[model samples]
Target: METNTQILSTEDLRSQEYFLNMGPQHPATHGVLRLLLTMDGEIVKNIEPDLGYIHRGIEKMVEYDTYRQIIHVTDRLDYLSSHMNNEAVALAIEKALEVEVSDRIKVIRTMMDELTRIASHLLWWGVMGMDIGALTTFMYAFRDREMINEIMEKTTGARLTMSYNIPGGVMFDLHPDFVKDVKAFIPHMRKVLPEYDRLLTGNIIFQRRMKGVGYLSAEDAISHGASGPVARGSGVRCDIRKKAPYSAYDRVEFDEIIETGGDNLARYQVRMREMYESLNILEQLVDNIPEGPYQMPMRTLIKLPKGEFYQRVETARGEFGVFIVSDGKKNPYRVKFRSPGFSNLNALIQAGRGVKLADLVAIMSTFDFVIPDIDR
Candidate 1:
C-alpha cells in the first residue's frame, strides 16, 4: 500500500487578526457602551471595554447638592433599579441621622424593592431574547412588565426614574389599589413565567447557546467583585439582602438563588428562580402591610453630621454601595458609589476570551449591566 499527502505552505496558513467595534451605537452593547474586540475568525481573542460615553460626573455633582437632592441623582445611575438606588442613599442618611423609620415604611420599602427587581429582570429577559433572535419574547415580556409599571406609577408617580425613597421613609404611602394589583399580578406572573420557560428556557437552541458558555469560576467571580446573579451563578454567596439585611429584608423568607454552573445558562436560571422568590416575598407581606404614616416630618434644610457613612443594597444587577462624607452641612463634602456594573464589567474581559464571538452576546446578556451605572 502506498499513500501520498501534501502539506500546505506557510503563506496559506497565515491569518490576520482584526478588531470589531460592538458599539457606541449597537443594540447588543446596550446603552452607548463600546466594546473593542480582537478576534481570530469567529473566536474572541480579547475584549477592551471603552466606557464614559454617558458619564455625567455624578459624584462631583453630589458634592454641591443637598442630602435630599442627591436622592434624585441616584435614580439616573441604574434607572431600572431606581428605587433601590434611592434606597441606598436614604438608608445612609437615616443611619447618619440616627433615624429608624416606622414598620409601615420598612414593609413598603421592601415591597417596592422586590417589584423593582422583578421589573428589571423582566426587561433583561426580553432584551436577552431579542439579542439571540427570538423577537416574540420581547413582546411577551414587555406586555407583562407594563402591569408592574402601572403599579409603580400609581404609587411613585414616575415610571423608570422614580425617586420614591426618602430619608427616614418613602415619599408616599402605597396606593389604594397597590395591594390589590400586586395580589392579582402575583398569580398572573406565576402563570406567565411558566409560559416564558416553555417558550425559551427549554428550547434546545437557547440551552445549547447558553450552557457551558462564558464560563466563570467562583474564584474569578469573587476576584472581579461580581454580585447578584453574576456572582450567584458562579456559586458565590455575596447577596447583600441575605448577608446584611436592610429595611424589612430581615423579616422576609426568601432563598438566595445560587447556581454553580458559572455559565450563561446558570446566570439565566438564577434570575428566573429569583422571580419566584420575589413573588413569595410579596405574597407574605402584601396583606400584612402595617398602617402608619409613610414618612416622618423633616426640616426644610437637610444636613448630615460631620463624618462618613456608608450603606449597601441588593439591586437587580448587584450590590450598589453609597459612601457619603458630610461636614455638618446641607451638602455632602464628598460622595461615591461603588457601582455593581463597573465591577461586573471588569469580569467581561476574563469570561469573554476564548469563547466564540456569538457567545459574547450571551455572556453580556447574562451580566444584565446598565451602561449608565458603569459610566457613573
Candidate 2:
C-alpha cells in the first residue's frame, strides 16, 4: 500500500539533490551502520553502507587456534545467536572429517538451533518495534527471550555465548533437566507469541508506519542473496536449513515463514510468523530426544584433509556458511564466513534508491543486522 500522498508541490527540492550520511551510530540504523544518503531533499536518491566498525579479526584468529578451540570465537561472530555460529563451524569440521554425529547430538543440535532462531526473532521483534516507536512490545518480547536464554544457560553454562556445540559433538553433555525444561518452554512460547498479534501486528499506528514501507521485490531479494527474514519477507522460501539440511534439519518438520509484500510490515509479519514455526519445530523435536553418545573422542592431533569444505546453516538472521580450505594441517589454509548481514546489507543500497529520509530507519531495522557480521 504505497501511500497515495497527493502531488501537492511539483518542485519542492525535487529539482535539486543533496547528500547526507545517516549513521554508523544511529540507533534506528541498528548497529554501527553509517548510511551515505544521496537525497533530493527528503526523498532518497542513493544509500551506501560504510561498514566494518565491529571487525574483530575473527577469520584470522581461527588459523592459529586448534580446531577444538575455534568454536568459542564463532560465538563472537553473531553474538545474538552464538550457538548457531558454534554449530555451523562444528558441522563444517564434521563434514570435512566425514565423522558420524550421533542421533542424540543431531536432535539436540536441531532443537537448540530452532530455539536460537526463536530467541533471535524475539529480540528482533522487540528492537524493530522500538525502532519504529513501539516500546511496550520490546518488554513483552524480552520476557519470553529471557526464558529461552535461561534455558540455554541451564544446559550450556552461559546464557548468550554458550559454546555448547563442538566439532565431534557438544562441549558439554545435555543437562538431565534439558527435556522437561525445553518442553515447558515450548508451551510457554506458544501461549505468548499470539500476544504479538495484539501488541504489534494488530496495532493501527504500527500498520500505518510499516504496511508498504521499504518494499523489496522477490527478484531483487534473490539477486542480492538475502536469506532468513530478509529473503522470506519478499516471499522467497529460501531457508538454508530446509534447502541444504545439515545438523538434523532433515529429521524435523518446519516451514519457512514467508510473505509477498517485502515491506517493513511484511518483515515484521514474517518474523512474527516464524516464532510460531520455531515453536512447532521445537514441539516435534523435544519429545523424541534420542539416547546415545553425545560426541566421539577425537585424537589429540586432529587435522583437516587437503580439500575445501563448505557448510551453510540457517541462522536466526540468515544463511551462515563457513567455507574452510584445509591444507592437511591443524589450521585452515583459508576461512570464509558468508555472514548473512553483509549480504542482507546489500539490500539497503539497492532498496534505498527512491525512499524518504524519515522512512530509512524503518527500512534498516527490517534487515535486523549486527555490524560485526558485516565487518567479520
Candidate 3:
C-alpha cells in the first residue's frame, strides 16, 4: 500500500490525466459551443472554453448593414428564440436614435419577447432533461415548443430566425388571426406543461440525477457574472426587464422566479416558473396590440446622430446590452454588444469543478449558452 501511494502521488495525478474535448460538434451541444475538459474517471478536474471558432464578427457585420439589415444578423446569434435577440438590438437602436415608438408597438414587442422567453425555456427544459437522463420530457417540451414556433412562422418569414422586430417597431402588424391563435395557445400550453411535471419534474430518477447536483453559491454566481436562470437559482433577483423596463414591460405585471438551491434543479425551477410568468405577461398584452404601422419606414440608411447610445434589455439568457458610438453618419464609429452568455460562461470554471461527467452537461445546460452570441 505504501509503495502504491508513493507511485500515485499528486504529481502523477497531474501528469497522467487526460484532457477531453466535448463539443464544437458534439451531439449534445445545443449550438456550436466547445468544452475542453480535464477529467479523472467520473469527475471533471478542470474545464476551459476555447471560443471564437464560430465568430463571424457579428459586431463588424452590423457596421455596414443599415439598422434594418442588423435585425437579420441578430437572428443567427441565438436562433432558438430570435425574438429576444431582435428586441435587444431594436431597443438599443431606438434609445440611440431617440426615436419614439407607438404604444401599440411597445405592447406588441413585449408580448413577443415574453413568448420568446417561454419558447427558450421550453427548449432548455427539454435539452437539460435529456442531459440528466430523462428522454420523454425532451419530446414533450418540444411539442409545446412547436406551437410557439408556428406562431413565429406565421408572423415572420422563418420560425427559428425572426426578423420580426425592427428599429422603431416590429416588421409586421399583428396578423388578423393573431388574437384567436393566442387565445387558443393559452389553454393548450397550460395543459401541455403538467405532463412535463409528471414525466420529469416529479419523477424520482430525475430528482436523483438533478437535485443537489452542480451547486453554485450566490456569491460565486454573481462574481462570475452568471445570469438568467443560473443567477436566479443562486438567489439573485436580477431580471433586467423588471429592473430596467423597456418597451411595454412597465405596463405589464409579472413575478420574477428565484431559487435558493443554486443546483441543477434550482435552475430548472427558475425556468419552469418563468414559463408561467411569461404566460401571465402575455395574457395581459396579447389582445391589446393597438392599431399602427409596423416597421418604421426609412428610405434613408442608418445616419445615427452624434454621440453614443447605450441600452440593456432582458434576453432569454439575461441582460443584453448594446453600445453604439455614432459620428452622426450612416455608419457607427464603434458598436459593442455586452452579451449575456459571455459573462455567464465565465462562471463555468467554478460551477463545473468536481462535478460528474454526466452532470457537466446539466451544468452547461443551465448556462443556456448560444455560441454565436458569445462569439459575436
Candidate 4:
C-alpha cells in the first residue's frame, strides 16, 4: 500500500481571534454591565466595557433635589454602601453651612458605616467564591450578612438603601438594641470570618486560580486611580479613612490593610483583613456611643452658601466623594460624585490583558465594584 501524507496551510494552523459579549445580562457581571471582549483562543487580548445600562442621571437628579433630598439620590448609586454615600453628601452640606453635628451622631454614624462596609464585603466574598466555583461560600457569607441587615433594618428602617443620613445628622436615634446587637455581631463575625479562610482561602483549587492571576502594580494602581481593596492589593495606600478621616473615623485606631502581591489573591486578602479592622472599629465604639440627639434642628429649607464644598468618605468599595456648588440656592447649582467603581473599572482592561477568558471573571470579582456607582 502506498502511504499518503497531508500538509496543513498557514491559515489552517492560525488561531482566529474573536469577540465576545459578557453582559447586559450575565450573572458574573453582578449587574447590567456589558463587556466587549476580544479573544485569541482562550486568552483575552482586549476588554471594552459598555456602561449606562443602569444610569439614572443621579448627578443631574441631585441638582433638582434639595440638600436633604440629595442623599436619597446618592443612596441608589451604591445601595450596598448607601449609609456611607449619604454621609458624604451630608458632610458636604454641613461643611457649607458650617454646622457641627453632635458627637453622638458622629459615633453612631461611624459604627453604622463599619456595619455597611462589612455587609458589602460579605456579599463580595460570597459572589467571589461563586465566580470561582466554590458554591458553599455563598451560603456561609449570606448567613453572617443577614445578621448585619437585621441590625441595619432595626436602626435605619431599611436594610440596603437606608437613606439614614441627612443634612445635619442621621435620620433617627439608634435603636435601643443597636449597641447590644453590634456587640453581638463583633463576636459572631470574629468566629465566622475564620471559617471563610478554611473554606476558600486555604483550598488548593482556589489558591491556584487566584494566586498569580490579574496582577496589577502600585504604580499602575495610582495612575489608574484605583481605590479600596483594588488599590491596596497593589500596595497603594489610598484608604480615605486612614489618609483623611471624616465622620468619626479620626477617633478610631485601626490598621490599613495592604498587600504587595498585586494579584487576585492579594485583593481577596485585602478585603478579608478589612473585615477584621471593621470589627475593631465596632468594638471601640459599640460601648462608647455618646448620649445626644441624632439630628440637629434644621430649618424647613436648607440653603448652602454660594461656594463649592467637597467631602469624602471611605465606603466598602473605596472612596466616595460628594462635591456641591451651592450658588446660595435651595438645590445645589452643580452636583458631582467621585465614585470608586468608575475609576476601578477603568483599570480592568489593563489588568485583564493577556489573562484567560475564565480568569477574567475572577479578576473582576476581586475588584469588587458596585456597577450602579459607576453608571451614576
> Which pairs of residues have clashing backbones in candidate 1?
none
Global CA lDDT computed for model 2? 0.84
Taking every candidate in turn, the Cα RMSD to the unseen true structure, in Å, is: 2.1, 3.3, 2.8, 2.7
TM-score of 4: 0.96
Which portions of model 3 show Cα errors greater than 4 Å? 1-15, 296-299
TM-score of each: 0.97, 0.95, 0.93, 0.96
lDDT of 4 by residue, 58-95 (tens): 88887898888888888899888999999999898888
Q: Which stretches of candidate 1 lie over 4 Å from their true place?
A: 1-12
Q: After superposition, how far is residue 253 of candidate 2 from its true place, in Å?
A: 1.7
Ranking by TM-score: 1, 4, 2, 3
- The regions of model 2 sitting more than 4 angstroms off are 1-8, 11-15
> Model 4: which ten-residue window has the lowest total lDDT?
1-10
Q: Candidate 3: give the clashing pairs.
A: 303-330
lDDT by residue for model 1 (270-314), tens: 999999999999999999999888997777788889999999999
Return the candidate ranking by lDDT, descending.
1, 4, 2, 3
Task: Give the best candidate by lDDT.
Answer: 1
Point out the higher-scoring one by TM-score: 1 or 2: 1
lDDT of 2 by residue, 1-376 (tens): 5344544357432476777878877778767778788888689988877877777898998888888788888888888878888898899998888899889899888888888888998998898888888899799989989988888888889989899987888877878888888888888888877778877788898888788888888999999988888889899999887788887788888887879888888888888888888888888888898898888777766799999999888888899999999999898888889999899989867766787887787888888887777888
| Displacement of the residue 278 alpha carbon in candidate 4, Å | 0.4
